[model samples]
Target: MDITRYNSEAWDREVESGNVWTKPVSPELVRKAKAGQWEILLTPAKPVPDDWFPKLEGLRVLCLASGGGQQGPILAAVGARVTVFDNSKKQLEQDIYVAERDQLDIRTVRGEMTNLAVFSDSSFDLIVHPVSNTFVADVLPVWKEAYRVLNPKGTLISGFDNPLLHIFDYEEYEKGILKVSYSIPYSDIESLPKDQLKKQLEAREPLEFGHTLEDQIKGQIDAGFIISGFYEDNSAGKEFLDRYINTFMATKAEKVYVDKCRDLA
Candidate 1:
């Protein structure tokens, strides 16, 4: 399957279906952001720590796989040079919409998360990536590419699903039932039975993968980023796992000068 093409189209359709992630922020939100009264979600509920970010004015920020007009427009309103790179054109359009409406300067690019060749080395000072990477099967390349594009001492704040979130019957989990089923590093492409996969494909639903912590956390270190901050969050009643363990985690990594990072260079 063409994962990129498939997921791209799936997300475009999601925008049409009014998926929450695809919704654009209101002009009022942008106004608030410009006034120093704003917050953006890196996880399900918790806003990213203000200290996790450097000063917004003049910062070059890439909203990686984040194009719903939620993060990029706000960052631009807060005085950052914001670029939103995402796979779905519809998702990018949402950012464009907010940019035009709020008269904010935000650039939108349509592309995959793993390959960021569209950007040059050290092109950005910060990257704000929400929980969109679960759509990709391989995540290490994401960290490596992110490291390549970020300036030294830059910050990368990312959110991703806990691998434990995947070890269950997905449908049952939505019903508030916990059924331990799938193994770690889950992949809808490889893990689902043929009949179920066929159903999902027929429905044109976006296929998802749950990457391991090694790929999520240690991958950043191998890519030369120093993990500086971390936090866990739940779905705020949207997920049953919220009642027990947090199903999502966000990290703040700083690009540092180190021999380990030079390996990637």
Candidate 2:
């Protein structure tokens, strides 16, 4: 099965079902954003720190894998040149709807988040990547591509799930029980039982992966990004775990020129 293709289409169904993330911002929200009264999320709940952002006016920003019409339109409304890139066509349409309705200049692109080849190197000054990396199998590629497309000193603000969330039976989460059923690096394809995987497929659920800290955090460092800021957040709809601990984390990274070693003589 093609996970990327399946997930893409599944998200489209989510849009049709009116999933909260697929909902576009209201005109009032855009108006407020234009007035500089706006906030966006990298994680589930807490708004990103104000200090973590550079000036929004005229910044070349890429809302990488963040196409729910939430962040992109807000950034564009605040004077940032916004491009929303996501795998879901319907998700991108939400951004387009808001952009057209609000008369904001926002570009929407449908593509795999990991393969940012459609964009030129250093094409963006900032990247707002929300908690969508779990949809991809390898997060390192996402980091590498993000690093490639951001300019020197460019910032990449990203949100992702803590691999700790992957260790338990998600079914048990609502029951307020943390049953140890899966490992750190979990996957619906590789980790789920055959029957469970079949059920997931039959239900048209988006398959997911649990990336390690090595891949989620260190991968950015290895990809030439300097980890500068950090914060933890809890999932909004998952209050059972949120009441216990933060299940998500957001990071602020900068792309800077790092010179390679000369030689090993």
**Which segments of candidate 1 are over 4 A away from where they belong?**
259-265
Candidate lDDT scores, in order, read 0.92, 0.92
Instruction: Report the Cα lDDT for candidate 1.
Output: 0.92
Per-residue alpha-carbon lDDT of model 1 for 1-265, expressed as tens digits? 7999999999999999999999999988989999999899988898998888899899999999998889999999999999999999999999999988989999999999999999999999999999989999899989999999999888899999899988888778778888898997899989887898999999999999988899899999999899999999988877677788998999999998666767887
| TM-score per candidate | 0.96, 0.96
> Candidate 2: lDDT over CA atoms?
0.92
Candidate 1 residue-wise lDDT at 64: 98
Q: If candidate 1 were superposed on the true structure by all CA atoms, what would the RMSD be?
A: 2.3
Candidate 2 lDDT by residue in tens digits, 1-265: 7888999999998899998888998999999999989999988799999999999899999999998889999999999999999999999999999998999999999999999999999999999999999999989999999999999889999999999888888778658898889997889899988898899899898899999999999999999999999999997756777777788999999997765564432
